[model samples]
Target: MAFREMFSKNHRTTDAAPPASTETGRDDTSFYDLKHKIHGRLIEETNLAALDSMDPAEIKTEVGGVVEYFLQEEQALLNEEEKRQLIVEVLNELMGLGPIEPFLKDPTISDILCNTYKDIFVERFGLLEKTSARFIDNAHLMNIIDRIISRVGRRIDESSPMVDARLPDGSRVNAIIPPLAIDGPILSIRRFAVNPLKMQDLVNYRTLTPQIAEFLAGCVKAKLNIMISGGTGAGKTTLLNILSGFIPANERIVTIEDSAELQMQQPHVVRLETRPASIEGTGTVTQRDLVRNSLRMRPDRIIIGEVRGAESFDMLQAMNTGHEGSLTTIHANTPRDSLTRLESMILMTGTNLPESAMRFMLSSALDLIIQSTRLTDGTRKVTAISEVVGMEGEVITLQDIFVFEKKGVDKDGKVLGRFMATGIRPKFADRLELAGIEVPEDLFSIDRYYE
Candidate 1:
């Protein structure tokens, strides 16, 4: 049951969903106005400073008592059930992110997008659906946005209209307000699983087969540097997390990101997050700085959340300088594009290295590129796993070890695809053998396909 419904026993939790809104109907508008009046009075009468020190139940009880007193005094036309729900809504507005708290608790929702005060959209099971939830006004939405960014020591205002932040649970949050936003305010939340997903979960979701999972685990154990390439919302981080799980517990690992998103399960992990510049236009830390710093920390593995800027050069140096087994994700459509993006980032460092040198560095540094894609049917799948086969003349060669071949969609619009081995044993298999990790012969057999 929702927090509001649980407040009163008389209010039965029914299958019927309430108007997915704050102030659409006349009753809703009146209730909203009443809520604001009570909210203002509570802010004045209640001890706001003591709220943080008290237990959630205690705060609810204290505030609920006050709300009850005011409800009788105001003589609002509401039933007992409605009165109880009002208190819960008030608590949510005061203590939580207002209308979006319930959505945050839902595991099935992968994304929460707020275009404005009146438009709230959430992605459930990879499909976008509009919710009736809304804020009182643009100011209300901006207040919630401020609460989110301020916790992370991030500032979002006229001088800095865009800010990237995270919730307490590590969900990625981005808020862009006026001037740049054009609209009143925009908030996008990319939710993470409370319990980190395991390899079995990926297999269960058909993101990859058991064989593919085993091969990836072996690659990680073998200390082969892997790159996850995908577009936005393509499950790159999730795949990166699963791959990182294969790293042995004894090794020291360091994670660097614009925001700390990788949920590394290792005991010996050092997390470093980048910082935005202050209003004075100073005190900013970039991913390149963290990547260079992680090198001195003696990390057996350096897992970058994403290689977006000049950090790619330092990353390649780390990879070539015996810091193997590193992992990262890049926003790209295919394996070739990932290489091009990496090349471009290297050029951004003002390194006078020629094209051939860059290609050689890339071919030697990255061992594997796992391409993840969200199909038209909203199903995410590992589209291809390509191995960097070193340079052939001026060009770097790549060979696919595994690929997902798409057929046609089913009647229900479910994507039809089969994971297949390319019958080519990746050169990394030698690295696995060197590390004493066994690679099953059937794993690379073309006939051994996963339907």
Candidate 2:
């Protein structure tokens, strides 16, 4: 027998039923069996031939009709309460998509925003476009949110109705409901590329050129403390992952993230993810908690997936104190903004450090900042490669070793720019020499840039 046919008769519907309804008088094993039976029977009885002809919504409606037929056939065996519960179960199975499909299938969409049941928006190429994909209603949306958070061992309700989770595909999910959201349910999904984009692939997309790629590789090889900066959908994490490829395959790496999206190709990579508190408000693992813990693991390179909040302070401390060649990303518009953002995050640690002290720490901890931007033409590109040159009094000083100079726009509305080098050789090059990596002195000559 086929798989669906086998499940139709022998499988228990209990597994598919809602948790609330599972408590009903029905036996879970029997209910699970009936559900699979109904699903198989519904598909058989319906116009399976015409399935391709119908829209997804219409197909769902027709499937609902089959469910009603199955319920009527079993009406004599079930009481009124059991029958009512079955109706809800059938509808949920037919109408609700498990919370993982939209994120995996969408190639162009970078982010999925769910403000409420009625509002859904997805960011495609830097523009937010409304989508027809939606839940059955607010209640249905809440059910999915419940199912998802429950699997991750998180919680959501009136009292603690906000949650952060990762779908099976590693897409980051943030959800807020009821009192906290006030707009029914709010869910934001930051989609991850199921297949991580590699550096060569990014170059094929015109995101960066080969020369800049070699330079970034050199920076990674030289153990330059590098931070990637960008706005939402600006490809900061993607660039970070690609840059991480330059690390020698022999070195041990520790990657820390809230959701664990970085796909480092190194064989010795240790992945650490943060944990959420249980329903009773116990067993929480914050990013700060993980960063501090990763320190003891003796990573050749410690990479915090993204530095936000107090974790920035610990990450900066790690880079300054023996963790060279460390990597992290930040949300900012420009390289300077990235430094300011780091300062703000460091202060979030509640250190109460003076502004000058924070600036000094940032300047000393960071060696290079690669800033990326999503241009008006709907493409994200690396715009500047800057070197941190220590602090001047109250201000952190930086020199752009390489910058993207946009000459002009093409007729097709694409922005054209060249990543040119500056004469300033990074202070860490001497250390790279000891590692048997030789970057020609002329590679950093500003006059030779764009030649």
Q: Using TM-score as the measure, which candidate wins? A: 1
lDDT of 1 by residue, 195-274 (tens): 99999998999999988988889899999999999999999999999899999999999999998888888899999999
Scored by lDDT, model 2 comes in at 0.77
Off by over 4 Å in 2: 1-103, 407-412, 447-451
After superposition on all C-alphas, the RMSD of every candidate to the true structure, in Å, is: 6.7, 9.7
Q: Please provide TM-scores, in order, for all candidate models, with all chains considered together.
A: 0.92, 0.77
Q: So what's the TM-score on candidate 1?
A: 0.92
> Which candidate achieves the best lDDT against the true structure?
1
Q: Which ten-residue region of model 2 has the weakest summed lDDT?
A: 1-10
lDDT of each: 0.88, 0.77
